[model samples]
Target: MPLRKADVVDEALRFIDSEGLDQLTMRKLGAALNVQGGALYRHFPNKEALLDAMADKIVEGIGDPLPDTAWFDQVRILGNRLRTALLSRRDGARVMAGTFSPGANTVIGTDKAVQVLSRAGLPPAQAGWVSFALFYYVLGHAIEEQAQLGLPPDHDWRERTGRLAVEVSPQYAAALDSLSGTDPAERFDYGLNVFVEGLRRLQEKERAAQEHAAR
Candidate 1:
């Protein structure tokens, strides 16, 4: 049977999982599929197209509906969900940050997030901007989290950096030491909460300024 496009995407993801993204090539994929390199071109015009498909596949499950909750909770849910999706596959976060088409899945996921922000009183443009900001923040955090996958769970990055800093200046070492026992997952949640809180504060400030201007 001839391979379908979805099959190609599935095999490509498997290839990426085992071989890593850096080693992905049309020729290699074709070899893995037992087809000529040109066969992939019929489905994807080029490597970038294949990468975009892979990225889309990585994030395809991000279109879940917003929960029945407060605006803050909605945003939190969306953010965490996106992070979870990106962390599902090997180097999935990097794939998401790379080439991708703004297809239905991407559009729906973004729309849900923007709707949450809009309900929180942000103007349409601001809500969209906030959604974009949150997406990038989650993507960057996931990338960092995945990059440390090979390290031991108890490894203290701050301690390693603190040692070098202490050799140069104790002040910097002390600062780094302050962050010494924080886990990456904890840090991710902390940063996300901070962002959500900041948005709340901004919404309040905007309303207050508008009231003041009206009076």
Candidate 2:
């Protein structure tokens, strides 16, 4: 049977979910699929290429582009949707964050997101930046969840990983605590609302400024 793009990504996702990102490799994926190890090379060209395709598929699921929703509504929905998609696959968030997609689905979703901001009266450039901001928020939340998902019952890794990092700021430590010690799905929703609410404030300020300037 010919290896379909969907089949290839599905196999890769299944492997990721079951084995974790640490164990995934092209050779491992092929063996899992019961195909000659070299056969994957024919379809994917390289591991990086396969990862890109996987990222694309994952990102494409960021929600079927919503053009008619309110600004906060669109951002909130995309944030939640993207987080769920990444959590669905092993290291999906990490891989997608490491890669950028100029592919069709990603671009279309991005364009539609900006369109919502534009309709809310932001200039084109600001809207574009906000679109990226929303994606970054989603990616950041998802990647953090991946790292802390399966804490040992004794919580050894939890204590170690939760220790304040040298690079992480003290001011952010409280926020960091919120990032762990809870269900990722709930945390994802919380962080997503923060970003959307922040955007809502900015949008209101912008609207007020625009109105004031006209007065």
Candidate 3:
């Protein structure tokens, strides 16, 4: 059977799921696909290109944005969906960290979110910046979640954190202790809510300022 680019990328993702991002190489991926390493080059050109394709595939789970949604809901939905997709594969976040496709799918998804914000009255540039910030927040949180997966479930980090917090200042230790045992999902939602709320206030402020200038 002849090899196709999609076939190579799909097999590569399965290889990473079993072996992890660190273990992925064209030579190894080709071996998994029952072909020579050189065969992958015809499809990917290099390992970086393959990783970029994998990153794009990870975001495909977001699908197209729904039509006529509130700007805040669009941001929240996309952010949550991106995190879920990254969590679906082993070391998926690490694989996607610096890779972006810049193709039709990625561009359309991103532009749609930014357009939502723009329609909410933010300047186009600010809307774009907010969209990028949401992307970064999702990527950073996913990476942290995946990295923590390697630690023993029962291992206690509280003592270590407490000691470091005390060294910073008494007030810092007290604040850190207050947040102990907070659910990860709750923390994610808390930060996300803060971001969207902050954006709302910012848009309101901008509108007020523009009105003042016009009056």
Candidate 4:
């Protein structure tokens, strides 16, 4: 079979999954694809372009948002879907952390999010800004989650924190203890809810001000 652009991306993702993102190189991907390193440059000008494609592939896998849901639910669903996609492959979050793809899937997903917010009564500018804010929150959370996953199996954050907390003030220890039993998913949901609730309040306030001004 002949090599294609999609072929290169698929193999690159596979390479990242098995060997981690830091280990992926054009030469290695080319070797795996059984072609010369120069061959990939035909599809992607450089490794950064390949990473962007891989990030787009991750977004592409998120499919579509649910139908007829409340804007808040829709936002939550998008955040969860993004997180799930990022966690699907090893170092997946790391692969997407700083890369932005103007790829179709990425643009479509972003547009949908902005549309949802705009429909919920936010101005287009605010909606777009909120969309990017939500994206960064999810990406940042996923990056931290993936980094933790990379740690040794027995690594216990609380246990480690407890040891250091004792040396710090009691208030610091108490604050750290607040995170005691919650898993990453729970923490993610809590943060997402907080963000959505804030957006809801802002929308309501804006609507109220608009109504007042019209009187």
Candidate 5:
């Protein structure tokens, strides 16, 4: 069977998963596919194009937000889905951060988010900004999460942090200790909840201002 663009992308992702993103190259991907490096250019003009495709693939896995859900819930669902997708592949967040594909899946997901926010009563501009804000929040967190994955299994993050805090700023050690037991998922949910609640409040304030203007 002949190799397709999708096949190339799949192999690239697999290579990334096994060897890490930094080790991926056109030559290696072609070798994995048993073709010359130039053969890849038939599907992707350059390494950048290939990376964009990989990032789109990650976004495609996120699927669509659930129907008939509240806007806040929809936002939460999308945020969680994106985080999971990024974490699924090794260095997935780095791939996503490096490329701006504007591919179909990216466009569809973004449009759906903007539509949800718009329906929640935000103006188009604000809705767009909020969509980007939600995306950045997820991306930033996923990047940090993936970075943490590189740590040694026996790493005691709290202990190290506490020691550093005590050495540099004893007064802030108590605050640092608060992070002792919480896991990444718990922290992610807490941040997401706080963000959504702030958005809810903003929507209410917008509504109240409109009502006042009408009066």
Candidate 6:
């Protein structure tokens, strides 16, 4: 049977989940899906094209912004949701990290993120810059988090903490110890709040400077 685009993307996602991104290739993917190598060529001209398709679909899973969601709500929800999706699969963040695709989902996701920032009163350039920064940070963190999710021994963090405990303040060590078993969701919320808060502060400072200069 001939494979459809959805089938191709689904197979690609599953292959990434099982084998990790480094090992994913058109030849290998074809074998995984029980199809000939050329089967992929019919849908995607080359390995690069195949990757583009996979990246597009992955970004596509980021749903449209809810009408009821405010700027903070929309941006927060989108950021966290995307991070989760990418981390859910093996090397998923790595696959989507530098992918440049013009697919529907990729474009729409960018539009929604930018729109949320614009609604908050930012001009086109600032909104675009910060929105991209937020998304990049989430992707970068998710990749690191997923990579460390399965440590053979949890003692690595302990050893590092011990080093910091010796040189850093006791309060720092205490804070680190306090989060030995911290909830991932809580950590995500805290970090996201920091990012958005920083953005708000920047906007406020810019507005204040403008007002002072006008006087």
Candidate 2 all-Cα RMSD:
3.6
lDDT of each: 0.84, 0.77, 0.80, 0.86, 0.88, 0.78
lDDT of 5 by residue, 1-215 (tens): 88899999999999999999999999999999999999999999999999999999988946574769798998888889889998999999999999966788888888888888999998899999999999999999999888878977777655786575546466465554544446889989999999999999989998999999999
Which pairs of residues collide in model 5? none
* Stronger candidate by lDDT (2 vs 4): 4
My TM-score estimates for the predictions, one after another, are 0.86, 0.81, 0.88, 0.90, 0.91, 0.82
lDDT of 6 by residue, 133-167 (tens): 88888887777677666555554555786775567
Model 1 C-alpha lDDT per residue in residues 166-208, reported as the tens digit of each score: 4546666565554444577788899999999999898899999
Residue 134 alpha-carbon offset, candidate 4, angstroms = 0.2
Tens-place lDDT per residue, model 2, 1-215, is: 78776787889988888887778898899899888879888788888887787788777755475656577887777777777777777788887876644566677778777877788778999999988888888888777777766655555533565674545556665665665556677876776788778878987897899899999
Q: Give the residue spans of candidate 6 off by over 4 A.
A: 160-180, 208-215
Better of 1 and 3 by TM-score: 3
Best to worst by lDDT, what's the order?
Answer: 5, 4, 1, 3, 6, 2
- Candidate 4, residues 18-96, lDDT tens digits: the string is 9999999999999999999999999999899999999889888454857797988899998888899888888888888
Q: Report RMSD for candidate 5.
A: 2.3
TM-score of 2: 0.81
Give the per-residue lDDT of model 3 (tens digit) for 143-191.
Answer: 8878877767664555777566545667765655544456666777888
Off by over 4 Å in 4: 61-65, 156-167, 174-180
Arranged by TM-score with the best first, the candidates are: 5, 4, 3, 1, 6, 2
**What TM-score does candidate 3 get on C-alpha atoms?**
0.88
Winner on lDDT between 1 and 6 is 1
* Winner of 4 and 6 under TM-score: 4
Instruction: Please give the RMSD to the true structure for each candidate, in Å.
Output: 2.8, 3.6, 2.4, 2.3, 2.3, 3.1
